[model samples]
Target: MVTVKLLKPYYIKTDEQTVRVVLAYQYFTLLINQRVFQFIPIEEKEIRVSRENGKIENIHDRFAFQNGKTVIYMSLVELISAPNFLNHLHSIAQPYIQSEETKSVTLKEETEQIIKVLEERNLKRMIDQALDERNKVLFDQLVKLL
Candidate 1:
């Protein structure tokens, strides 16, 4: 499964010679038995602008899956049009992004740990089977020699 989120709005120049507004968004993709599924995990958070100072903010999140791999991302927009854009962005991202003061674990780290455990288990099984076969062959040879 792959997840993606829009960390910020992506502005693209269109053929019409105009800049298009794309909502910062996040999505996720899942693959099972050669089938692929895509979904948007985060709903459209309202874009808020503060009148006190020029600042604008929006949050978009998404995920993606390709070639049996999954990725997640968060989309955030902070325009200087509003005074509190930075503060709002920080407040929203705080739960997802780790701070130096907080001991937070990542999804990649957890996946790696699980993979290491499984690999070790498989390797031990292979070694045991090989040793068993070798012992059987040695015993047969000894019997023949006797």
Candidate 2:
């Protein structure tokens, strides 16, 4: 049987890097030297999150550093984990996640507002799938709850 896994938020740490977000799941953003790096799933790099006190030594990255691309050791200046970051990631990721017809115009807005919109869209997709599958219990329950 195919064991499908549900997507959920994750925090992971590697010996070389501390990746807080995984692309195509939630969001990934890295700010280095006043530059912002957003991770998209298509990059196929399989970005992983690292725990606190992680190090980036020996990780070869081309566009992340100003002095050079290949980084040996580095330090983080500041970190922001508010929903606004998530919204920013969502805005950047939406085009890749959704088709043109369903894509919404990007706007500078609050994080809470954007999260609500995303959640609603996800719910609609689930309900639609349940309805299409013709599962009596799931469809009926979701239809009533929704």
Candidate 3:
């Protein structure tokens, strides 16, 4: 069994259109088989939640965290289903969440983000292929896109 808990005071960084919620390390943790685990920050783990509906933009995504060099995957969907998850989210993230009147995201910004994610995914795929083929030159070129 797994359990989720939001530890306060949550860490939040906000730019113009989105809030970056830092969960790895301190703000969040996982409990499995009665043992507690601390999340390792993988991929700089920038999670974006929509200001419009309070839903994670990548709600279907699963992120990998490390436990003593062993990798564990957890889903955003599973975490949100925890008891009182919304109440906890509201309580912890309320200070940063904007009012309904001002919470709208422009289509342009959303489209741009989608494009960025797609490009990054492509770069990662190419990078992996380069490594698999032992093509250091191509790998270097792809990494520079990061």
- TM-scores across all candidates? 0.28, 0.24, 0.53
Give the better candidate number (2 or 3) by lDDT: 3
- Per-residue lDDT of candidate 1, residues 16-77 (tens digit): 22222333323222333445544333454333433222233333432232333553333343
Q: For residues 1-146, could you state the per-residue lDDT of candidate 2 as single tens digits?
A: 11112222343333423443333433434544444444334323233322332222223422121223433222221121322433443333333342433323333345568888888788788889987897778877776766
Residue 20 of model 2 has an lDDT of 36
Error of 2 at 48 (Å): 46
Tens digits of lDDT, candidate 3, 20-134:
6766675666676666665666744546665545656766767565557667877768766765645665666566667765544555578889999999898899999999999
The lDDT leader among the candidates is 3
Local error of candidate 2 at 29, Å? 51
- Which runs in model 3 stand beyond 4 Å of their true positions? 6-10, 101-146
User: Candidate 2: what lDDT?
Assistant: 0.40
Of candidates 3 and 2, the better by TM-score: 3
